[model samples]
Target: MGNFLCSSSVGRKLIMSLSGCFLVLFLIFHMSMNIAAIFSEDAYNMICAFLGANWYALVATVILAGGVIVHLVYAVLLTLQNRKARGAQRYAVTVKEEGVAWSSKNMLLIGFIVVLGLLLHLYNFWYHMQLQELLGNHTNDFGYSPADGVSLIRDLFAQPVFCVIYLVWFAAIWFHLTHGVWSMFQSVGFANATWYPRLKLISNIMATIIFLGFAVVVVVFYIKSICPACCVA
Candidate 1:
């Protein structure tokens, strides 16, 4: 079954679409969770504790990792196949904007940047917090409890360099989603002309909401770090 599913162009796209949808669901939950931090530290930490090293959280993490790996692998495979089919014409393109967005043309490059951002995020939070708990360490390397993720986020974003990097990461995500969301719909047979523009609009809305939600946490925490006297949490 696995061989049959991955041995054809349509199967490859179907796999990508399914994995992309799963990831989109995860992103929505994650974006909502980040926004919770702006409302209350204790509330956010409660969520962190709930998702910490538990059986369910572990399961979810593994599933999320699988989705990421499969999506990235299939994307690379499909791009290589397309390039092979296009031959020299792949590089012989003359004047883009014939129709597709630039993001569609450079999705692989954008995906690479997104992966870099993910690594930075995992280093900052996952390793320090979840990995510590999984390893049975009561306190993280930062000398804080594994459950003290709020402080981790605050400290990471306090650094101007990390803050700027995260914002740039968010920008890349925005571009990727604007193209990806609509394309996924089209891939799965929603390519009817009447719904095309509407899907594009929906894609943009989703991308903006996700970017703003995640960005708010980073920007807010960074501001509070610089001026604890006045800024709200």
Candidate 2:
């Protein structure tokens, strides 16, 4: 069974699907954390401090990183394997297939964008706060307390360029999730003739919800930065 999972195509996909699902769950949690910032910076920072450099949080972070690595590695392997299997036929098919979403066809490209965005996010947030804390720093490079997530968010999104870049990143994630969510279930044999459409709809809804949840926080913070006095009241 272990060899089958490690060596077979179906096994590789199953591993990828499971890891993707795990990451999606983490996204929901992270999105919820961002949403909390919109309501109360104190509350958000409390959450961040609770999760920063703590044993459990470190363990969770390691697990999350593992999931990300596994998912990306398998995605690349499967894409290459599929292309090899298709050979010249891959280029020969010029017409669009019914029910094949554009995201499904261009997932690898979108995945790269998603990864680049993820790296930017980690550098901006994780490196500043948790990594600093782990390194025994009391404050980040910006001089804000490592746990001061609200200030970080305010500073990062206050810039117009960052706001635009993050919005674009969110769109890339939406594209990835539109196909990925349902595909996760499909890999586990949960998708079929009766359930495919339903799963697709669910995936779209989930993607949109996550996109809006994170985007709203960025937009709101940018607005607040523009009119601090108005926001205070």
Candidate 3:
């Protein structure tokens, strides 16, 4: 079983599908947490405190990191394998293929953008908060407590440049998810004549929901930063 999984094409895709699904669930949970900050900073901070540098959170973080690594590795391997199989034919295609989503064609490019965004996010939040906590520092370099997610959000989003960058990142993630979600199901043997369109629709809806969920937090915080009186009143 292990050899098959490591050596077979179908088995490799199965791995990607499983890891992709795991990451999608994490995205949903993260979006929910970000939404909480919009409603109540106190509640959001409390939640962050519970999760910050704790044993369970750390364990989950390690596992989530593993999933991300596995997903990325498999995606790259699959792309290379496909390109090798196609040979020069890959470049010979001049006309756009019918029924194929543009996102489906450019997933690797979009995924690269998503990864860049993830690195920025890690440096901004995780490095500041959880890493500080692990290093025995109560407060981050920004002069706020490590778990003070609300303040961090406010400080970062207050800069219009970061706001634009994050929004663009979210859009890239949206593009990645649209094809990824459908591919996840397809890899698991769900593709068929009747279910193709349905799966595409489902993937689009899930991607849009996640996109809106994360985008709303950034948009709301940016607005509050510029118009403090507007949010308070």
lDDT of 2 at 163: 96
* Candidate 1, 79-169: lDDT as tens digits: 9998888786455458875777999899889999999999989999999988999999999988988988899988898999999999999
Residues 1-233, model 2: lDDT tens digits? 58977799888888988999999999999999888888888999999999999999999999999999988988898898888887865564488889689999998899999999999999999999999999999999999999999989999999999999999999999999999999999988997999988999999999999999999999999999998865551
Task: Give each model's whole-structure lDDT.
Answer: 0.90, 0.92, 0.92
Question: For residues 1-233, what per-residue lDDT tens digits would candidate 3 score against the true structure?
Answer: 58867699989989999999999999999999999998899999998898899999999999999999998998899999999897965554487788878898998899899999999999999999999999999889888999999999999999999999999999998999999998999998989989988988999999999999999999899999999876751
Cα lDDT of model 3 overall?
Answer: 0.92
Provide the lowest-lDDT 10-residue window in model 3. Answer: 88-97
- Cα error, residue 63 of model 1, in Å, equals 0.4
The better candidate by TM-score, 1 or 3, is 3
- Return the lDDT, model 3, position 223: 94
